[model samples]
Target: MVQDALAGAGYPQHVLVACSGGPDSLALAAVAAYFARRGHVDGRPVTVGAVIVDHQLQPGSAAVAAATARTLKDLGLAPVQVRTVEVAAAGMGPEAAAREARHTALEAAADEAGAAVILLGHTLDDQAEQVLLGLARGSGTRSLAGMRPSRGRLLRPFLGLRREDTLEICRVEGLDPWHDPSNTDPAYARSRTRVEVLPLLEEKLGPGVAESLARTAAILQLDADYLEEVANATFERLREPAGGGHARNDRTGIEQAGKGISLPEAALRDLAPAVRFRVIAKAAAAVGGQQPSYQRLLAAEALLRRHGSAGPVELPGSVSVYRLSLAQLEAEGQSAAAGVPREGARCGKLVFRPQRPSRK
Candidate 1:
């Protein structure tokens, strides 16, 4: 299955396996090395290498990383490299920080090795856990889509396999997998989800909840792909060009004038809620504004639906969205309620302006 995934992704030349000495990664390293030595994946010759990233978040991490690299070399994986990365606890917490650091290290190692793809060992169980977390957080469809088999240079070939299968592979190959203590620690949400939540779900849901969740993720992924395509097309149609240009002949009355994009109140009101909100979000992002939250999007939509209501809807990153007419843009020094102009604008344009930081 791993070999098939790599081939299907058109990454058959050189691949880097992200090994953490865990059962999943060890199995991946063994399988990948075996295929590379056999001289073909999908009838094409391949070279396999391994990278072990030590986050140094725990005691004896250097020794663990070194041991993992040695095991990879013994498994017939050439060019085994050990990279030590510093994990800073950002706002997203230690797990996310470590993940970001690990990916950075793996990408650097892959580039150094001239590898076409970086293979990860995320299994079906991990995908199920991710979907469940997304559900718990009430995140939208994109979050529930779970991990993709191929995302840019990162590939997860084992996503279709169960966690037990990797453990079995390790046992049959006589690979001593290093069990990371963090895997069982309750401090991390993923650890708690894996050790406690999944088991309880299996007990109550009658044994296949994980499989069902994985299937749900696959279906949601398809839906998300289609929706994104539609959203992108709609955004393009609704967006006013950066420079002054005639708007499309659509009834939406979108206009581009002097560095601002504008949509008529009637144009937005006629759109499906999904397409409308997506276009609004895309418009905000195109103007160097931060992606707004669901609430912010809703507020912007409400402003558009209302007639003759001038709003200075404040968004993240000090960006603000306004609903002003062409007459208002021509005026000078409008009142606070009418919104202060930060840059050039023409009437009927929904302007996204980032507030300039005050000089110290």
Candidate 2:
């Protein structure tokens, strides 16, 4: 299934499997190698490598990483690239932060190795947990989509496979994987959700509840994608640059990329309700540096449409929305969106400062 999925997606010949010596990751590495070998036997071959990231949060992490590398080499796999990265914060306070750091390391490694896709070991069980967590957040649409199969260079090939299946694979291959004690520690919310909540729900609700939740998330992702497309079209028409951001003299160019979702208040109000809502939401998202919810967007729309100079309306990411005038919706800064600014002359509110200012 893993090999078929990769081929179906037109996955690149060079593959990088993210391994951590855990059962899930170990199983993924083994499965990936199996598929690659089969391809080689069938006249088509793939170059496969494994990368193990040691967060160094534990004393034995380095040793575990080394063991993982040794295991891969013994299995006729290429030498595992072991990366020891600092977790920065101590203890279990920043689980999300640690995961982000680990992903960053994986991306950097993939880029360095020229690997087109980084395979993750996230099983169906993980997907279910993500759905449960997303539900807890009480957000709508996009929030419920959970994890994606293809996110940039990272791909979760094992997401369709069950945890039990992965464990069985490890057993068949005589792979002894270490269990992370942290996974069972009640100190973590996810651990409690897994050990306490999920089991109880499974008993009371029904068997295969986790699978149901994952399926739901998959459906939600499709809906989210469509909504984003509609939102993008609506956003393109009314966007303008925020304060201290580069301006776009080429409205046609900016519109094509959906950056102008930060349009002025006057420009936004001229649109119909559906279009207005999307424009407002996009503007807030651009200003807030976070994905603006429909509710937040509605509030922003009300504020701007009412022509209220009440005060700066706070959005995500230290961004504020202001009605500089009846026709103007001013964002605090140009960082409503992530990444570097586009190249061009300054226009509207978005400013472009060249690395070296032209002195003629």
Candidate 3:
């Protein structure tokens, strides 16, 4: 399955397996090495290597990293590298921080080795856990979609495989897998999900809960992808050009009317709610604005559809959206010229403005 996934993703001549000496990664390393030694991943010869990122969060982590690197060498993986990463405690908590740091190190290692893709060790269980967490958070469809099998330079070939399969592979290969202590630490939500929540769910809901959740993720991923494509196309159509060209003032280059996106009120009102909300969200993001909550998006949608003389609705980052008519735009221009800026404009059409520079 791993070889098939690699091949399907356009098997590169050089592949890097992210190994943590765990059953999943070890299994991946073993299989990747086997295929590489046989002169092909999906039928083409390739060079396979292993990269173990030591996020030194636990005691004896360095020793564990060394052991993992040695194991990778024994598995016939060449160019085994152990990269040390400093995990900083940031807003997302220690577990998230460690994950971020680990990924950064792996990318660097893959670049150093000239590997085209970095293989991850996430299994179906991990995908299930991720879905449950997203559900708990009440995040949108994208979160429920869980991890993709292939994302940019990262590939998770085991996403369709069970954790038990990796363990069995390790056993058959006579490989000793190091169990990370963090995997059992209840302090992490993922650990709790894996150790307690998933097991309890399996016991109560029958044996296939994890598999069912993974399937849910796979289905939602398809929906999310299609919606995103529709949203991108809609955004392009609705976005008004600036100075007869695309909006390029901001780093993101999303065309802006003023400090926000201006779309024809009719055009936006005609869209389905799913597509409408996504367009609103994309507009916010294009202007380098934070994601608006559902309520906020609804408020924006209402102004467009209901035809109200309402709002200088406040959004995150001190950004504001207002429905402006040609008359209102003329009035605001007069007010600005008269040295008294309008406080807020009535809602009739959408208008975006660039953020004003702070006075020094």
lDDT of each: 0.78, 0.68, 0.79
Task: For model 2, state the Cα shift of residue 261 in Å.
Answer: 7.3
RMSD (CA, Å), candidate 2 to true, equals 8.6
In angstroms, the error of model 3 at 17 is 0.4
lDDT computed for candidate 2: 0.68
Q: Which 10 residues in a row give candidate 1 its minimum summed lDDT?
A: 247-256
Ranking by TM-score: 1, 3, 2
Using all chains and alpha carbons, the TM-scores for the candidates as numbered come to 0.87, 0.79, 0.86
A best-first ranking of the candidates according to their lDDT comes to 3, 1, 2
Give candidate 2's TM-score.
Answer: 0.79
Q: What is the per-residue lDDT of model 2 for residues 142-171, given as tens digits with 9 covering 90 to 100? A: 767878887877788788888899999999
Model 1 per-residue lDDT tens digits across residues 308-338: 4366676765555667654653452232212
Tens-digit lDDT track of model 3 for 235-302: 88777622222222343333334435566666676688899889877776776668887788777676
Please state every model's RMSD to the true fold in angstroms. 7.2, 8.6, 6.3
Off by over 4 Å in 3: 241-260, 305-319, 332-347, 352-357
Q: Find the candidate with the highest TM-score and give its number.
A: 1
